[model samples]
Target: MSASRDTRSQDIIDRVEAAGLRIPAWQAVCSVLETLGEVLPYGTAAYLASSLPDSMGAEVGRHFPADSSASQVDRGDFVAAVARRCGCGVEEAERAVHAVTDAIAATVPFGVMVNVEHVTPEPLLDLITR
Candidate 1:
């Protein structure tokens, strides 16, 4: 990644930590991106990633669908997956999710996040928005 992009990626981790996720900031940010891979539609994932800093955008794009498909997951499943990835409980996972998503919201363009909102389910929708 370019120097500026690397700096921006670090900034995202910093924001996540500032938002109170207890885990290492990079891990928390990565966990949230992986969870998004499970939940988001292919096009939406690609679009979302495009708006991120280079490292994060590439990380998220790793799951971008060749087949234009995504795994079926609800809010509970999303949190559970994040918990598993982070080796934490549901509540901590939620905090990580919130912290990372908040960071993403602040970092990415508003329109990109709105696309994510439109594709996300109801209870899970609250996670990104909150």
Candidate 2:
């Protein structure tokens, strides 16, 4: 890996570890992102990370806030909303949801790290392998 990627990876690993999530869990999250990034556009992984919910839920209703006027919807709601705004069909929206959920499952234990640079796959995998 390039020096920059190595540095970025280390930074992500440190941030995740500092948030107290288990290494294995973080690894799993990174693995999913890496796979998704390969299949999607360059920024898709970052976009997914930005849209994840703060907690887990079986459905959008369960995770979204009770108030419709809230600035921050549940992470799940935010992602689904984004998909709708993008004009994606049901299956595409579901895929986006899954990508966001997978990311959240990886990071919640650690804490939310919003820095896209930190989680990009080249750096993320380097961090994981080390």
Candidate 3:
């Protein structure tokens, strides 16, 4: 990877780690999504964070139609395309993609919490930005 790409990936890893959500597995996922956000024209990172699986799957399918039948290839290509678009090295994009895929796999079972009354969005967003 190039120095800049390495630096950007590390910066994202460090920021996410600092957020107290640093499960070794999830860190990789967040990194990829961050990179995707950096690369893709559309807001994939935000969509992944907020959308349901079916919606995200459809979006992913629509934007990256590699082989109508083989979704994994499309997903991989999408990540690579996003990385290329974002100006990141291929290795960096691959790492980010793997990390994100792993993170999503792990988080799916836990489900999401919607108790806005208890959660503070600012601190979480601040943590991510910082």
Best by TM-score: 1
Q: TM-score: which is higher, 2 or 3? A: 3
Among all windows of 10 consecutive residues in model 3, the one with the lowest summed lDDT is 112-121
Q: Candidate 2: lDDT of 8? A: 42
Q: Which stretches of candidate 3 lie over 4 Å from their true place?
A: 1-67, 71-79, 110-130
Q: Ten-residue segment with the worst summed lDDT in candidate 2?
A: 54-63
As for candidate 3, its clashing pairs are 28-99, 29-99, 29-100, 32-96
Expressed as tens digits, the lDDT of each residue in 14-37 for candidate 2 is 544454432233343343343333
Q: Flag regions of model 1 displaced more than 4 Å.
A: 66-72
TM-scores, one per candidate: 0.89, 0.28, 0.33
Off by over 4 Å in 2: 31-130
What C-alpha lDDT values do all the predictions have?
Answer: 0.80, 0.38, 0.39
RMSD in Å for all candidates:
2.0, 15.3, 13.9
Tell me the tens digit of each residue's lDDT in model 1 across 1-130. 7887787788788888787666888888887897786568878888888788866777677655653333345678789989998989999999888889899888878899889998886668778887
Residue pairs with clashing backbones, model 1: none
Ordered list by TM-score, greatest first: 1, 3, 2
